[model samples]
Target: MAARTVKRRHVSSRLSCKLFIVFTVSIFCVVVLVTAVRRNVPLDFLWGAFFQNGDVSNFSIYVHSTPGFVLDESTTRSHFFYGRQLTNSIQVLWGESSMIQAERLLLSAALEDPANQRFVLLSDSCVPLYNFSYVYNYIMVSPRSFVDSFLDAKEGRYNPRMSPKIPREKWRKGSQWVTLVRNHAEVIVDDEVIFSVFKRYCKRRPPIDIRKGKLNLKLQKQHNCIPDEHYVQTLLALHGLEGELERRTVTYTLWNQSATKTDNKGWHPITFSYANAGPRKIKEIKDISHVYYETEYRTEWCHSNSTSVPCFLFARKFSRGAAMRLLSDGVIDHFELSALLGNE
Candidate 1:
């Protein structure tokens, strides 16, 4: 009787130890899969509903908002963003290498999650066009990262000085907003050679005033490089990972042609106003099935899981009023439901 009791005790102790080890490993994996972000952007009222019907447990949000900025009931509408900011957030500047630094910081924080399969980079102006489930499934179904890349169009944006670290042949340009798979995200986070070259060589040239002659003659010939625009696309190209990307951005932007024509500075995307944030405009963006790269002379027909699909999952530069207008109108939720039913 004494021997049998001792044997039972020994087996129970071993079973408990095995369970503890498995539990620890499972927690580690969950911590590894949470996603990351950096946002000064206010959450659109509708974005809350985007995840309402979905499995919120599957997605994690990590933010890299402006240093010292807090996301609480006073700052944002959603609890999801609360306490999401990175502790080591840095000040970001437009048209500078710091932009890419901020992106890298966000990516690094997100990569800690072993479960994170996709990493998305967004700007303050961006807004989700579909609900969370649709967007999540859309990205998860495809193996490719959505990286909008093409040949440089604006002359003198590439500095030959960057070669051979960033070869002239590998020099590419694209929108900064991108969705990367874990491997591509790792490549960006782990990159030292290409990012350092960009920090040293890729800089946005100041607007030259030839008439005023305020700029130096040498400066006029300097290449005007925007690091954020080129960094990810060029970095992926340098690593020979272009084939793993969808070669297009999931975020939509409307370049103001009229402003581009009138302003000599350069083109900037138009900010959608409440007046323009209607169901019709949302549908138009959703209807876009392809993107044409004039510089590369290549047309990208958007597809996911070998099924032809609309190009954009998100749209940007929406005013707070425009975002509220989208929510109150129920246009986004309606469209998302429609798409979901269509899929079924």
Candidate 2:
């Protein structure tokens, strides 16, 4: 009876050990499953979050008139006049819509002027640093206007987003603010294949899958999906406008180390000083001189220009104090605004 009891105890002990092993394995599996589910849950949540707010159906444009101020009345008048001129130009090219609607309007204008010689697009901030005759002469003498850089045909990789019918070589890229020749403008507005692709893919979110799982560094850089940078470059390169571009733009901008933001909010006003010449100020004058001398009144790649126009047609984020310095006849004279305006 004792031997039989010992045998029973041994069997029970073996069974308990096996049961414990099984329980441990089961617990391990559960933990792994839970971790995997938790990881996947965030991706789903992220997708849902982006999708719900990602529909851009209600996006609209807003246009605000510059507020009246007591600075130089002539400068103020020029600013307003330039604004109205831009508004009128858009009106002639396309019908009314919100500020967001301006892109489509521009497309319409492009379509109406396919041969690329009708209008020039300028921003309110751009002041002519050259006289009207110089500008007109430069445009007339140039082999191609600013639009050519944006809309010429050149060899490049094919964009799947664009229609297969349109070859991958006839694209162009440049600043949104440009002097458009009538024919090229028509081509842009009339380009059903390319424009459809652009409109579909050129919004806040690109339809391409290239950026998946990469921490969206591209989005952070430009702060939007299907940023204008990618849109113009890809489209123009695909459409064959690569070689026609003069590789220069007349605008100027300063994005150097000295322009770095001091605040956590990343806002820095433009500062002009007679005693302290910053990078932007120095670069602006240097670029102006280079263009005036080298290109004979033409500038190419004004803004860092690799992605878009290198510099801006006008620099913003200026303090009210800076504006006074900019408006002064002495400073303005030194910068040759008087020569550029000719009649102001």
Candidate 3:
């Protein structure tokens, strides 16, 4: 009887192990390319490197371009993006509700693939901090999605007019670039109530000069609200999915502190030039282990599967010249090689 029991236990363990492997292999990540133009030059090679040693089936790509633009070989260098543009894409404007519309469209398209267990939103300028395997393992092992959500106290960007449909208490702010799980992505796609309120009330306040000629005095007083910045964060909060998010963005961005809202220059994230896209700058971003949100007084320590990990998986706002430098420097390729050796 004891011998029979031992044999049965061993058989069950082997079966469980095989099932786990199958589950892991079946799961894949969807990279949502949310950009107006074709994919950046370096990203083509960098992403190619990602799948060089792995199965292409383990991941998928979807691009959300403007209405007329297509992501074929004429516009992009890689064959991966050929014919990836969404047929239903609309014209996208900065700081407008249209930006969020593009995101929703991309999510809706990616969700069609049931095998996509994770969804990561990336821009044309965004670059991977680690190799594909590291990023895959980091995102796949986590139980929750990565979203940079925090209280909107400062800036007073939250419009009071949106209250009732979107209460001030539930109004949150964060980076538009986020990595969501399948459930959260579905929530974003299915949402109609909060998104309608945002389109109606939440809009970017026109610049002082532009408002003088194009707007009435009433439009001048409207609160400045960047829809993409607040839409995902607020929508998730409204759904009471706060516990299911990491509350921090994996795509790091450096804002130009000198450019204030009052200045005609306007506020924008700093774009990396070829001079600043060297090894040291990349290392600095990689070294970030925690992020402190001043408004909420919360510090988010990065982790994957309970083990401490770097805060950012990707960094954005790189110019085409800077991106080319990254490829020429072998910076990304080195990481891919190191990641492969580490696994062995």
* Prediction RMSDs, each to the true structure: 15.1, 29.2, 11.3
**TM-score top scorer:** 3
lDDT tens readout by residue for model 1, 6-107: 000001121111100000000100111112233323442455555455555456566555667666765655555556666777776678888787777777
**In candidate 2, how many clashes are counted?**
58
* lDDT digits (tens) for residues 1-344 of candidate 3: 00000000001121111100000000124444444543333355555554454446556677676566666665655565566667887777888888888888888877876666778887766776676667777887787889988888766678788888888888888888788888998999999988899899888887666536756566667787889889999999999999988988888887766755467555578999989989888888888888877777677888766778888877878876676667666755643433432232
Full candidate order by TM-score, most accurate first: 3, 1, 2
Q: What TM-score would each prediction reach against the true structure? A: 0.82, 0.43, 0.84
Clashing residue pairs in all predictions, respectively, total 8, 58, 0
Estimate the overall C-alpha local distance difference test score of candidate 1: 0.65
Of 2 and 3, the candidate ranking higher by lDDT: 3
Better of 1 and 2 by TM-score: 1
lDDT of each: 0.65, 0.30, 0.68
Cα-lDDT of candidate 2: 0.30
